[model samples]
Target: MSALTVSQEEVKRLKGIGFLNNKGTDDFSARIVTVNGKVSASQHRLMADAAEKFGNGMLAYTTRLSVEVQGIPYEKVEEFQKFIAQEGLTTGGTGAKVRPIVSCKGTTCQYGLLDSYALSEKIFHRFYEGYRDVELPHKFKIAVGGCPNNCVKPNLNDVGIIGQRIPVVDAEKCKGCKKCAMEAACPNGFAKVVDGKIHIDTENCRHCGRCVGKCPFHTTDESIYGYKIYIGGRWGKKVSRGRALDIIFTSEDETLDMIEKILLFYKENGKKGERFAETIERIRFENVERQLLPSC
Candidate 1:
C-alpha cells in the first residue's frame, strides 16, 4: 500500500474528532463514544471486529466511560468512522464543549440511590449530543454518582449530580434505644443520641439516607429522595474540588432545567479559555450562585 501523510492542522482537527496520533508513524487511536459506560453485547462484538480489522486488536476503556481502539493508520480513519456509524456509534468527545456524560451502574448496585444510568443517558443526549458543536471557554465535563459513595467522583467534574436520600426522623415512633440506629447507619457521624433521643445534625448530614430502615422502631423515613448539584469542579494538573450548592432538585425535569441554565450562564459570563472553576473563582462563587439560583 501507499504511505499516508497528514498536516499538523489536519492532525489537530483529527484529534478533535476523537482521533489521536500514536507514537508509530501515521498510526492513530480512535476514541469511541459510549453512554454511561453502557454498550450492548452486539456493540462489543462490533468493536472487537473493528479493533481486529483496522487497529492493533487492542481496546482500552477511558475514565470518561468511553472506548478507544489504537494503532489504526491515518488512511483508514474515514472508513473506520463509517463502519462505527452503522452501529449508531460516533466520536468527538474532545473539544471546548461538553464531554461525554459518565455514571456508575446505580440501577444494579446495592448502594445506589438512583438510576444513574438512565439519568446519565438523558444528560448524554440533551447536553453531549445537543451541544456537540457549541463553543465553550474550555472543555466541560459532567458526572452522576448514585449516592454519597461517589463512585464516579462527581465532585471532580465540571458539573456533578449526585443522588441523595434525605432521612426524616419520626419522633413519635422512636424507641430511644441505647444504641440508636443512626449511630450505626450514618456514615458521616451526623446521627447521635442526645439526651435519650436520636438527634440528626442537619449540617453534617450528607442526605444519603443510610439510617433509613436501620431503626428497630423504623423511625427513619425514606420518602425524600432527590438530586444535589455541584459546580466549578475539575480534576486536572490543577485540581479543584467542586462546591456543592444548597439546592436539592426534587424532580429530574428540574435538575435538567438547572443544568441547562448553568450552561447558558457559563457561556454568557465565562471568559475565553477559562474553566468553569476559574470563572467561579474569578467572580466569586456567591455571585455566580446568585446568578444561577436567584431565589436563594
Candidate 2:
C-alpha cells in the first residue's frame, strides 16, 4: 500500500467530475447532486454513511442545492461514488457546465406561486444532465424562486426563473371599501383606492398577485401564473445582479424552451474564459437583449 499521487491536471479533471481537492492534502471532497435541495430518507442514510466512512463524519450543503462529503482520500473516490450509486445518487456538477438547479420550497410553502421543486428538477434533467459534456468559459448557475419574495435569490444566478401571478381585477364585482383589502395586500402599493374603487397601477405592479386572495369581495382574479426570466446575473469577486426580461413564460414547456435558447445563444457567443455576465457587458445588454428577444 503506497500513497496515491495526484497531479495538478488530474486534480482539475477530478474537480470537473465533482471531486474537489482538499487544501494541503491529497484527499478530495465529493459534491453530490441533489435536485432542488431534495433528498429522500434512504438517500440521506447512505450519504451519512459515506461521510462517516469515506470523508469526515459530516456533510456540507452547498448554495447550489448539492451536498459535499469532505476529506475523502484520493484512492477512495471511486468507491464512494459506487456506494452512493446504489441509492441513485451521482456526482459531477462542476466545471464550465450548467450547475445544479437551486429552488426554494415553493410547493409546500404558503407564499409559493409555483412548484419550484418540480421546475428545478425538470431543468436539472434537461440542462444539467443534458449539458454535462458541454464546455463553457465559466460555470452557469440557475435558480428558481417561488414568488416575488425571492427566497432563493434568482436574480443572483446566471439564469433566474421567478414564479409570478398577475392579478386581474373585475371592476364589476367591486365592493370597494374605504380601506380595500387589495390595497393592504399589495407589497408594492400597486393597489390603490382611487375614487372609491380599487385601482391597480399597471406600471408599478410587479404582478406578484399578493392582492388576489386578499380581496374581500374576491374581485382579484389570478389571470396569469407563470415565470419571469432573468439573464446574465452572477455573484463572485465581481458581482452583478441579473437583469429581468419582460418575457413571462405562461407554461413550464415555454420556460424550458426559453432556457434552452438562452444556453444555445451563450454557447455560441460567449467568449473563451469569460463569464455570461462578462459576455453581456462586452457585447452590450441591448445587443444581447435583441438576440434573446427579437420580437421585442
Candidate 3:
C-alpha cells in the first residue's frame, strides 16, 4: 500500500463538508445530500455526470438515503460541489447537526396510512434545512415510516414518526354475526365478538388499521388517522429502541412543532458529544417529556 499524504487536519475539515478520506489515498468520497431521500431526474443526471467527470464514476447509496460519489480527488472537491450546485444539489450530511432524514415508501405503498414522502419532505425543509447551520450536542437522525410495518426502521433512529389508523368501533352497530370479518381482519387478535356486539382491546392495539372496514354491519368501518412519534431511539454499535410519546398527533403542524421543540430542548440541555438518546437517559425521560409536552 502507499503512505498517507492528506493531513489529519485537512481530513477533519473535509469531513465536515461531507467528504470522507478514501483510506491511504488523498481521494475522498463526496456524500451528496438528497434531502428527504429524493432527487429530481435532472439532479440524478447531474450526479451521474459528477461521478464520471470528477469521481470514480461510481455512486453509492447510504442507509440514510444519501448518495456518495467515490474516488473524487481532493483537488476536485470544490469543483464537484459547484457542479452539483447547478442542479440545487449539495454535498454534506455530516457533523453533530441534523442528519439527512430516511423515509419509507409510504406515499405509494398499498398499506401506507399516510403520505410519507410529503411528511418527510416537510420535515426536511423545516428541520433539516432550517436547522442545517444550528450545531447540536451530537448528530440527530430522523426517520419517517409509513406505517407500523416499519420498513424504514423509524424506531431505530434518534426520532421516528410512524403512521397510524386507529379503528373507530361502533359497538351499537355490530350485529354479532356468526362469521365475523373483524376476527379475520385483526392480526393482533384483539378484536373479539361478545354478547350482541364486537369489542376491540384498544390498549394492546398497534393501530395498524387492519381492522378498519372489516365488519359486516359497519361496526369498524371508519378509522382515525394519526401519527405515532418515538423519541430517544438510537441505532448502530449500542442500539436503543425509542419510546413512543403518550399521545398520537393528528395535526401535521402540531407534530412539526413537537419535533422542533425536541431539538430545541436537546440543544439547550444536552451535553456536547452526547447523543440525544444518552441525553434522554441521563436526564430521565419523564423530565424530558414534561418539557416537550407542556400542554399534556
- Which order, best to worst by lDDT? 3, 1, 2
Number of clashes in model 1? 0
- Tell me the whole-model lDDT of each prediction, alpha carbons only: 0.89, 0.88, 0.91
Task: Evaluate model 3: give its lDDT.
Answer: 0.91
Over 1-296, each residue of candidate 3 has an lDDT whose tens digit, in order, gives 45668899999999998999999988999999996788999999999999999988999999989999999988888998889999999888999999999999999999898899999999998888999899999999999999999999998888999999999988888888887899788888988887867888888888999989877678877889999999999988999999888889999898888899899999999999999999999999888888888755
1-296: candidate 1 lDDT, tens digit per residue:
33447778988999999998885368888999999889998889999999999999999999898899999898899999998887888877898999999998888899888999999999999999999879998899999999988988999998999998988888778767887867888888988888778888988788888898888887886558999999999987999999987788889999999999989888888899999999999999999888888987
Candidate 2 per-residue lDDT over residues 110-197, each given as its tens digit: 9888998888999999999999888877889999999888888898899999998888888877887987888888888879988878
Regions of candidate 1 where Cα sits further than 4 Å from its true position:
1-4
- Candidate 2 global TM-score: 0.95
Output the better candidate (1/2) by lDDT.
1
Candidates 1 and 3, the one with greater lDDT = 3
Off by over 4 Å in 3: none
Query: Would you estimate the TM-scores of all the predictions?
Result: 0.96, 0.95, 0.97
